[model samples]
Target: MNDKNDLERLRIQIRGAVQGVGFRPFVYRLATNLGMVGWIKNSAEGVWIEIEGTRSQLDLFLLKLEQEKPVHSLIQQLQASSLVPLDESDFEIYPSVSGEKTTIVLPDLATCSDCIRELFDPNNPRYRYPFINCTHCGPRFSIINALPYDRPNTSMNAFQMCDRCRTEYENPLDRRFHAQPIACPECGPRLEWWDHHGKRLASDEAALQAAIQAIQNGQIIAVKGLGGFHFMVDARNSDAISTLRQRKHRPDKPCAVMYPSLAAVQKDCELSDLEAQLLTASEAPIVLLRRKANISVLERVAPNNAYLGVLLPYTPLHHLLLSALNFPIVATSGNLSNEPICIDEREAIQRLSGIADAFLVHNRPIVRAVDDSIVRVIADREMILRRSRGYAPLPIALSKPVPTCLAVGGHLKNTIALTIDSNLFVSQHIGDLENQATLKAFKQAIDTFEQLYEVHPDLIACDDHPDYLSTQYAQHRSSKFPSSQIFPVQHHHAHIAACMAENGLEETVLGVAWDGTGYGLDGTIWGGEFFLANLTDFQRVGHFKPFRLPGGEKAIREPRRAAIAVLYELWGEAAFDRTDLTPVQAFNAQERDILQAMLQKELNTPWTSSAGRLFDAISALLNLVQISTFEGQAAMALEFALEHISTDEFYPSVIHQGIFDWSTMVEEIIADIEQKTSGAMVSAKFHNTMVEVILQFARQWKQKRVVLSGGCFQNRYFSDRTIARLQAEGFQPYWHRHIPPNDGGIAVGQAIIAASQLLKRGG
Candidate 1:
C-alpha cells in the first residue's frame, strides 16, 4: 500500500509465438484487471511489456500471464527486470514496431466454431459472410504481408470495418476485439461466377447453382478457394469424374473430396478416432479415410484404392457452396497437368479454360499462393502428405537454436526453409520447379517468407544436384550474401536427416531412404539407400543394385522400359521371348526397338538404384500398367493389386553381398505368370517378399532404431506393415510426424544437419 512513495517498475520480454495470435489482447485484459499501469507493444524481437505498479500487483500479473496465455500462443521465454517507476494512470496497447528483423510468422488457421456458428446464424449480421473471421480463425500466414500482424499489413486492409465492428474492436469484452480480419457481408469480398469463355455471369448465386447442376449432370467446374483454386465435380458421377480425369490429364492419381460436413464424411468412409480429430482440427487438412467396402462413390475418383481423401469445408464460401450442393464433390487443384495452381482470375481463365466448364471465383487477391494440406492417420497419429494452408509459416520448434540459415529444397515438390534466431519456418508446397510458373512461384514464396519473418539469412543450403532449379536459385542468391556460406547436401542424406529431426534423434539410426530418383554422391541416381545417419554425419551402408535407366527420365514415364531393363538383367534376349509376356500396344515397334538397343548397348543410359523403378518393372512385367500418367501411378496400381493377395507364406529369395537378389523375385513372378497364378496371389507374394527382404536386412544390422523415409513411405500398405513387423521385433521405428515423409521435408533435414555441423564447428 506504500508503493506510492517507493514505486517499482518492471520491463518484461516475452518471446516464442507470442505475436499474431491474440497475445496482445490477453495482455491488455490481464493488465487492466490487475490494476497495473503499463503499455505493451510488439517489437521485431517479441512482445514487450513495461509495468509500473505495486510489487504484489506485478507478481499477480506475471503469475497470470504464463498460466492464462492465449489458447494457441506458446511462450518460450519470459524475462522480467526492475526499472525506475513511471507513474502512469492506465495500461494501454501500443502499435507494433516496424522494420525490426525477426523470424516469427503466424500459421493459417481453420474457421473457428464461433465463426462457423455466426456464418450459419440467420439473425447474425455476418450471416452467410464469405469472409467471416476473427483473431482465432481465418487467414494468417497466407494473407500477411509483414510481421507484427496488424490489419494494414494484410490483404484485409482494403476493407474497413463498419461502426458496429469498430465498437466491437474497441471493446475488450467482445470476441472480435482487435480482430484484424473482421469483416461483414457489405464490407468483405464476394463470390462471382464466370463461364468457360471468361464471360461474367448475370447472377452470382444463379451461376453457382447452374455450375452445381452441370456437375450433377456430369461436368467439371473450377472453384476458387482461400489458398488457390480447385477443379470440382460430382464424386458419385462416374462420367463426370472420368471427364475430369481426362481433361486434367490425371489418369490414375486419386482426387480428394469435399464433403458437406463431418457427418457426411463418416457416411462414406470409416474414421478412426485420430482421423476424426484431425479432420476437425483447426488445420482442417484433407484426411485419407479408409472407404467402406462397396461404397457408392464413382470408381474413377480413387480407382483401386481402399481409402479416399476427404475434407470438410475450411472456408465460409466453401460451406455456403457445399450447403447448397447435396452430394460430395471431387475437389482437386485447378491447373493443367504438371503445373502449379492458378491463383489470379485471369490466369485461372487462361490456364483452366479447356478443363473447367465454369469458374466460381472471388475478388480478394491472394498475396501468396498456397496449396491444400493433405494428411493421413497412421498408428493413431497424423502424418502430413502436403503441408500447406493451415500448417505453413508456423515454425517447427528445434531442440537447439542455430545461426540464421535458408535451405533450398529439391527440384520436385519444391519448398524452402528459413531459420532466424531459434525458430524455423518452412514455405508451402511450390510444386515442381521445372516449369517457369512454378519456378516463379518458388521465388515469390521464398521472398514472402523472408519478408514476413524479417529474416536475412546468414547462410544458404541447397541440394547437391547441379541441374536442379533450386540449386540455381541458391547460387543466384549467394551473391547477395557474400559472407554467407552455401552448403550442398546430398538429397538422400537430407531425407534421412529430415526424419531424424522430426523424431528428435540424437544418436545414429539406420535410415532406409527409398524414392524414384536423386543425384547420388557417387554421380549415379540413388533412391533405395541404407545409411547409418545422425544429424551431423551419415555413412552409406547398403543400397539397391544399379540398373540402367534406359533413356534416362523417359523410362520413368513408361514402365515398359523399366520392365525390359529388369528382364534383360535376369534373362538377357530370352527376357522378351518369355511366353508369359504380353505385348502391350502402348509401346510401338520403334519404341520397343530403341529400348532393346538401349538395354543391349547401354547407350545414353544412366544407372539408378531406385525401388520405385523396381515397382515400375513389376507393373509392366504383369501387364498391369503400360504407361504412367502420374508420377507414381504404376507403383500405386501395383500396391492395389498386391492388396488382393494373401500373405500366408513367404516367397523364396536370395541375399548376396547385402543386396537382395531381385533376379530371383523376377523369376518367381515369371514362373507365377506362366503357371497362371492369380494376380492377387502374385501381388501378395511380391509384397511379402519385399517386406521379408527388408526385414532380413534389418536383422543383419540388429540396429535398435530404423528410420523409414522417402516418397515411397506414402504407400500405406508398405509403411504400416513394415512398421508393425519391425515394432513386433522390439525395434523402435521412426517416421516423419510433423512433416511429409517425402522430399517436401528435405529442407527440415537440411536445416537440422546444417545446424549440427555449425554447432560442432563452434565447439
Candidate 2:
C-alpha cells in the first residue's frame, strides 16, 4: 500500500555482550515477522544489521529491538545510520567477519530454566543429555578459544551436529537457533568414567551410575564441570571428608557443599530471600550462609566455622547426579591446596590421582580454568569472596576512559586484570603464586585474556612489593614490551582505588584500607592504614601503631609468636616471665627465651602495622587459635567467638600524632584476663574498639564518602556494623559487591590506578 519512495534503510551496530546470546537470530526473527528485507551478521565489534522497509516498519523494528532483547543479552552501545536500501526478498544471517576484536565475551551461564525442564522431561529427545543447551544457557568463556563466538571457534567444533540439531540451529523461530554449543546425545560429547589407575570403567548412563555408586561408597570422585573439575564426596561421610582433607592438603579451610534442592538447603542452613535468589540465579555461586543448629553431618565439613558455603546444582549433570542421590555433597575445587583447578582430563587425572578415587570426565575440552565463585551477604548487599566460574572475564565499567593496561595483582589470592577502552576485565581467581605451577597458571590467565580480547597493553601495573612474584612478572613483561611503561602501585592505595573504581567514584574520598600485610612506601610492612584517595592518587593520613613481627613470616602461621611480640612491645623483656598468659604457657621457657633474644637482637624481626597480625595476637591471647592452619583462620575464629552482648561498649584507646595505638586496648584486655572476664566479652569489646577507632577517624575527616577495602573488610559482622554506624553518622560508606575485598580484587584497583596515571601524563 505504501509507495517505494516511502521505504527507508537502516544499518545498526550493536556492541557489548551481544554475541553468543542469540542476538543475530533474535534480529532475524524480528525482521522476518515484520516482512522486512535485511541481513544480520556477527563481527568482532559485535552484531551488525541492515534492514530495508517502510519508515514505520523500520521504526517499529528499532523499538522492538530494545524492548524484546534476549534475557542474557546486554546492549551497552547501539549506533544506527541511514543506508541505501538493497531490494532483497528475504532476510539472511551472514557468516561472521574477523577483525580487531572489540566485543565483550560473555561469562559462562548456568543451565537455563527451559533447558532444565527439557532435561527432566521423558518425552524430550535431549532428555538426560549432559551437553543439552540452547542460546539462553550453557558454556561461553570456558569453551571459547577465539572471537565471533561461532561454532567453529568453540570446543564443540570437534563434534559435528546431527540433522535435527542442524535444523533447529538454522531455524530462526527455534530457541536453539544459532546456539553454538547446541547438540543432542546422539552427536554430542559423552561422559566416561575411569578408575584412578587410568582404566576404563563405564560409558554414558553407566558412567553416571558408576560415579553415583562411588560417591555412595564413600569414595572421592573428580567430576568435570563447565568451568573445571570438582572433587565430589558425600557430605555426611565424615571419614571420607577427612580423607579428602588429608589428601587435598586443605586441613582447616572449609569446603563448599552442593545441596540436592533449595528445600534441602533450607533444612540444613538458614536462608534469606536474597540468598535464595542468588542460589537460583543464572550466575549460581557458592553463598556463605549461617548454618542451622545441630546439623551434625556438616560438623567435620565446615569444622569450627559458624557458616557453610552452599550452592544448588547449576548444570544438568549435577542435577541428574543430585537427583539420584537426594542428599548434599561436598563439591570443592579439583586441585591441591594453593593451585589452579584442573581443566583437561589428562591434567586432572595427573594432578588429582592421589586425591580422587575415580573420575567422571567428558570429551568436551575446557579452554580455561575457572573455579566456583564464593560470596556472602554484608551490609545487606552481596559481597564476593572469590570471583571465578560464573563471573570471570566480565568487564567492570570505569567512570572515564584511559589507555590499555595489564595489572598483575598482589602475591596472595592472585588475580589479573586488563583495560580496554573504559572497561576493565578482571580475570578469574588464580591461586597464590607460590610454586612454579601456580605462577605458570597466573601467566596463562593473562595470556588468555590478552588473546581473547586482542589487547596489547600500553601500560603494566603491579604491587610495589619488590619481592613478590607478581611484581617480578610485571618487570619481566616490561622487558618484552619495551614500549610499555611499568607502574608499581602501593598496596593499600591500590585496594582503595579498586573499591572506588567499581563504585564509579572519581572524587576524593576517605579510604580505610586494613588487611594483614602490604608493602608500604616507607619501607615497612603496612596493613592498617587510612588514606585520602581518588582513582589517580592517594596520601597516607593515619595508621595503626607499628610493632615488630618476631621471626618475620613465621609469625603469620604462628599467632603465639605475634602475641609474644605484642607482650614484648608493652612490657619489654620481663613480659616473658608472665607464665599465666596463654601465649607464655603455650611456649616452653627455652622457646620463650629464644623468642625474647630474637626480639631483642632484631633478628628476622620486621616492623609492621598489620591489622591482621593484631587479630591473630588477640585470638592467641583468648586461647582460641594459637597455630593457624590456613589464611585468616585466627581472624575468622575471632569473629565467630562474639556472643550476644552490648554493642555500645568498647575498650578505651587513643590516637596520638595520627597513630591509632592499640596499647591501651591490649592493656585493658590483659586486665580483663586477670579478672577472669569471659572470652566472648573480651572479643566483643575488641571488635567494638576497632569500630570506635573508625568512627573517631570519620568524625575528624571532612570527607563524607568513606571507602572500605582490604581483606579485613571480609568480616561480615565488622563490615555490617561499620556501614551502619557510618550511615547513622550521615556518612556514605561503600564496599565491594562483585569484586572481593581480599587480594583477589587488587588487580582491578591496580588497573584503574595505572590507567589514571597514564591519562594524567597524556598517554
Provide TM-scores for the models. Answer: 0.93, 0.98
Top lDDT prediction, candidate number: 2
Give the poorly placed runs of model 1, Cα more than 4 Å off: 1-10, 33-37, 51-68, 84-89, 202-219, 479-484, 583-590, 644-648
User: What are the lDDT scores of the predictions, listed in order?
Assistant: 0.81, 0.90
Pairs that collide, model 1: none
Q: Name model 2 segments beyond 4 Å from true.
A: 643-646
Per-residue alpha-carbon lDDT of candidate 2 for residues 566-631, written as tens digits (9 for 90 to 100): 999999998899989998899998898899899999999999999889999999999989998899
Task: State the number of backbone clashes in model 1.
Answer: 0
Displacement of residue 696 (Cα, Å) in model 1 is 3.3
Question: On a 0 to 100 scale, what is the lDDT of residue 422 in model 1?
Answer: 67
Q: What is the per-residue lDDT of model 1 for residues 327-431, given as tens digits with 9 covering 90 to 100? A: 789999888877888888888999998999888887777788888899987665788989888788677777767777789899888888887666677889888
